[model samples]
Target: MKDLLGFGLRGRLREGYTAADFRADALAGLVVGIVALPLSMALATAVDAPPQHGIYT
Candidate 1:
């Protein structure tokens, strides 16, 4: 029972993960970030600023 909840409070020192999981998550995040970047740049330009300024701000 303790093992099921990570050894009764101390918790598991190591957890499981896979390369495919990481790659998929990273790819999805990158796609969303890239999509947001263009819209942000357009908004910044409308406000009379450089595109990168939107990214920084």
Candidate 2:
């Protein structure tokens, strides 16, 4: 669709970032990283490999 195709041109970050926006984005990234780290480690353990090996994957 036209909207989907043009979505990338609408940059939320480029529009003008306030301190709140930066804090929000950083917090979201941290949460995702926290959740993903254990999941990745569990996956690697399931395969009988070290947790660090998941990072390489």
Candidate 3:
């Protein structure tokens, strides 16, 4: 199982995350949110719904 999971499990068991890993995850989430912002608004408009509805989604 360890071999199958590979280097993702490289960290010490007691300290599972590093600061760099946290920063990278936060940046990735921010990017996805930015990209989704306009897309959600467009989708809502296409369906004749309020922009907030897509944002809620």
Instruction: Assess the local accuracy of residue 6 in candidate 3 as a C-alpha lDDT between 0 and 100.
Output: 69
Model 2 CA deviation exceeding 4 Å by range: 1-14
| Alpha carbon deviation, residue 47, candidate 2 (Å) | 1.1
The TM-score obtained by model 1 is 0.57
Greater TM-score among 1 and 2 belongs to 2
**Candidate 1 lDDT over residue span 1-57, tens digit each:** 446655443342345456777799899999999999998888899999988888876
For residues 1-57, write the lDDT of model 3, one tens digit per residue.
Answer: 564556655544336777888899899999999999999999999999998899989
**How close is every model to the real structure, measured as TM-score?**
0.57, 0.67, 0.66
Would you give me the overall lDDT of model 3?
0.84
RMSD score of candidate 3 (Å): 5.1
Ranking the candidates on TM-score from highest down gives: 2, 3, 1
Provide the lDDT at 55 for model 1.
85
Instruction: Select the stronger candidate by lDDT from 2 and 3.
Output: 3
Model 2 lowest lDDT segment of ten: 1-10
Per residue, candidate 2 scores C-alpha lDDT tens digits across 1-57 of 454537654465468777898899899999999999889989999999998998776
- Spell out the clash pairs found in candidate 3: none
